[model samples]
Target: MKPLEGLLVLDFSQFLAGPSAALRLGDMGARVIKIERPGTGELNRQLSIKNQMVDGDSMLFHTINRGKESYAANLKDSEDAASVKALIAQADVLIENFRPGTMEKLGFGYDAVKELNSGIVYATVTGYGQEGPWRDKPGQDLLIQSLSGLAWLNGNADQPPVPFGLAVADMFAGAHLVQGILACLVRRGRTGQGGRVEVSLLESALDLQFEVLTTHLNDGGELPQRSAVNNAHAYLGAPYGIYETKNGYLALAMGSVIRLGELLACEALAAYQDPKSWFTQRDEIKQILVDHLQTRTTDEWLQILEPADYWCADVLTWKRLFAHDGFKALGMVQDVGREDGARRLRTTRCPIRINGERLFDTNAAPKVGEHNASIEQEFKLRDAQPSVGQHQPDGGERI
Candidate 1:
C-alpha cells in the first residue's frame, strides 16, 4: 500500500504552491478533494502559461492539480461554509494559500480547523509571513525571486539580473510545506495530535539560497561575484560554467584547471597552477578556455574529456534530451486522461519510487464542481448546521 493511501486531503489552495503540495500527497496515495469556488473555481484554471490551454482549462492548472476531485462552494455563504467545515471535520489534512486573513474571514483558519478536527495537519502558504510588512504583496514567483536576491545569482556580472523561467518560489514553498506536513503527520501518528505548517514564497526563495546567503552573512559581508563570462554559479570558480563550442555548448563542473588544460590541449590554462588563482583570476582563465573551446564541437570536447573522467558534459536542449537514451531510460513521463477520455495530457510522472515501483495516476484534474454532489453525499455535508451570524472569535463561521 502507498504511504498515504488512507489519508484524506482537503485542498483549498488555488494556484501553484498549495496545490502542488496536494498533488505530491495525492501521488503518495492521499485522497485529495479540492474545495473551489462555485462557477469560477480556482483562478489558476485561467492562469495559462505561454497561452497553452487544454480542455478549456489552463495547462498550468492540469500540470499541478491532476488526480484530484473538485467540490464547488462559496465560503462567504453560510450554508456553503457550514458544509465545508463539516468536510474539514473528517479530513486528515487541509491546505490553503489564500492571503493571510482571507481564510480567517471565511472561518477556516488553522485554529478553527484544529478545533473541528484536532488531528488535522493544517498547512498554509502566503507571499510573505503573516507579520511582515510585505505580507500583502502578491506572492508571484518572479517578484519573490527578485526580492530575495535570487535574480542576482543568475547571468553574467555585466548582464541584467535574471529570474528563473520557472516558478521556483511557488514550487519551493510547496515542497517546504510538504516537508512540514509530512513531519506533522509523523508526529500525529505518535502523539494523536496534529499541528500547523506555514510557508511563504519569500521564505522559500531565501531558503533556496541558504548556502550562499549564509556565507555572505558570516564572511565579513562579502558579496557574491558572478563570473563576467560564462556565469553559471555566483560563487563557483573557473571552468565551472557552460562554454560555447563549435556546434553547441559544454558544461564543466568543479575540476582541476591544470588537468582540463592538458585534456583540451589549451596551453594558457596550464599557467594557473595555483588553486588560489582559480578564484582570483577566474575571468581571464575562463576567457582563454572559452576562446579555445569554441574551436571544437561539444561532442569532440566530450569525447576527449569523458574518457579521462573529467567533470564535463555536452549541454542538451529539451529536444535533444528527449531523444537521448539516458532520458528515455528513466521512464519519467506519463499520460493522463480525463474521465470521459475526450483528451489526454502527457506530462512528467512523480519523480519518486516506492518498493521499486514508480507511481502513476491516470486521473486528470476535475472540472469545477464536478464532484460536489457525490462529495456532499459521502461527507453528509448537506445536514451541517450553518452559522447564525458573522465570523466568530474562534474563526468558525458557525458550524
Candidate 2:
C-alpha cells in the first residue's frame, strides 16, 4: 500500500512551491484536489507554451501538477467560494502560495480555514514569510539567491553575481513544504488537531547554504568573492575540481585528505601530500596541481583516476546525461503520463524509490476543472449548496 493511502489534500497553490508538495503527496497515494482560479488556472499553465502537452495541455504545468485532480473555482465569486470552502472542510491538508496576508484578505487564511476544518494541515509558501521585515516584499528565485548569498558564491570574482540557472529557492521551498506537511500530519495524528506549516523561499534558500553560512557567521568574515570556473574548489587544493578533457570536462575530487595525492596520479607531490599541508599552504598546492592537470587530456587522467579509485565524474550536458546508460540502470529517469507506452513522453522520475521500484503512477495532468462535477458529488456539495454566483476575475490581475 502507498504511504498515505487515505489522506486527502486540497491544493490552492500555484506555480512551483505549493504544487510541488501536493504532487509529492499524490505520488505517495493521497487524493490531491487542485483548486485553480476558474478560467486561467495556475500561472504555470502559460509558462512554456511550446512545451505544452501534445494534446494541447500545459506540459510545464503537468510536470509538477501531475497525479492531482483539478477543481476550478473562483474564490472571488460567491457560488465558487462556497465550493472552495466545502472542499477545504473535507480535506486533510490545504496548501497555498499567495503572498503574506493574501489568504487572510480573501478569507481563506489559516484562521478562516481552521474555523471550517480545525484538524486540517494548512501549509503556506511565500517569498519571505507571513510576517517579518521582508514579509510583503516580492520574493522569487533570484531575489532569494541574492538575499541568501547563493548568487555571490557562484561564478568568477571579477564577474557580477550570477544566478544558478535552476530555481533553487522554489524547488527547495517545495521540499520544505512536503516536510512541513508531513510533520504536521504526524503531529495531528497524536493530538487530534492540525497546525500551520509555513515555509519561505528566502528561508529555504538560506537553509540550503547552511555549511557556508555557519562558517561565515562564526568568523564574521566577509564572504569570499565569487570564484572562477577552476577556482570554485578553493576550499580544496590539488586533486579537487574540474579538469579539462579532450572534448569536455571531468570533475575529480579527493575529499578525504589522505586520498588527495593518490587521486592526482602525480607522484612528484607525494611529500607535500601531508594533508596538513593543505590547511597551511593550500594556495601553492592548488597552483602546482592546476599546472599539472593542464598537462593531460581528461580521458587520460580519467583512465588513471578510475583505476586509483578517485571520486571522478565527467560533466555531461542534460542531453548527454539523459542518454547515458547509468541513468536508465539507476532508474533516475522514466516516462510519466504516457498513454502510448512507447516511451515518447519522457520525464525524470521522482528521485525516490521503494523496494527498487519507483513510487509513481503515470497519470495525465487534469484538463482545467476536469474534476468539478466529481469533486462536487464526492464532497456532497451539490445538494447542500448552490455554486458561488460571482465570476472569478482573470488571473494576472491584482485581486
Reference-based TM-score of each model: 0.96, 0.87
Q: What are the runs in model 1 whose C-alpha is more than 4 Å off?
A: 384-399
Residue pairs with backbone overlap in model 1:
none
Instruction: Superpose all Cα atoms of candidate 1 onto the true structure and report the RMSD in Å to 1 decimal.
Output: 4.3
How accurate locally is residue 126 in candidate 1, as Cα lDDT from 0 to 100?
Answer: 96
With a 3 Å backbone cut-off (N, CA, C), the pairs that clash in candidate 2 are 78-388, 79-387, 79-388, 79-389, 80-388, 245-298
**lDDT score of residue 198 within candidate 1:** 96
How many residue pairs collide in each prediction?
0, 6
Model 1 lDDT per residue over 1-399, tens place: 887887889999988999999999999988999999999889999999999999989999999989999999999998898899888877778999999899988888877787778777899999989987898998888999999999989999999999998899999999999999989888877667778999999999999999999889998998989999999988888889999999999999999999999999999998999998888999999999989999989999999999999998888999999999999999998999788876899998899899999999989999999999999898789986533222122211111
Which parts of model 2 have CA positions greater than 4 angstroms off? 49-54, 225-229, 255-284, 338-344, 385-399
For model 1, state the Cα shift of residue 116 in Å. Answer: 0.8
For 1-399, candidate 2 gives per-residue lDDT tens digits of 767778888888887888888898888878888888777788888777566554455677878877788899888887788878877766788899998888898889898887777778899999998777998888778888998878877765467777887889999999999998888787777666778999999989989988877777786675543334455643445455665655678786666444555666656566675677754555466555666677777777778778767778888888988798986577755556634342245566677676666786677677678789988888886556432322121110110
RMSD of each: 4.3, 6.2
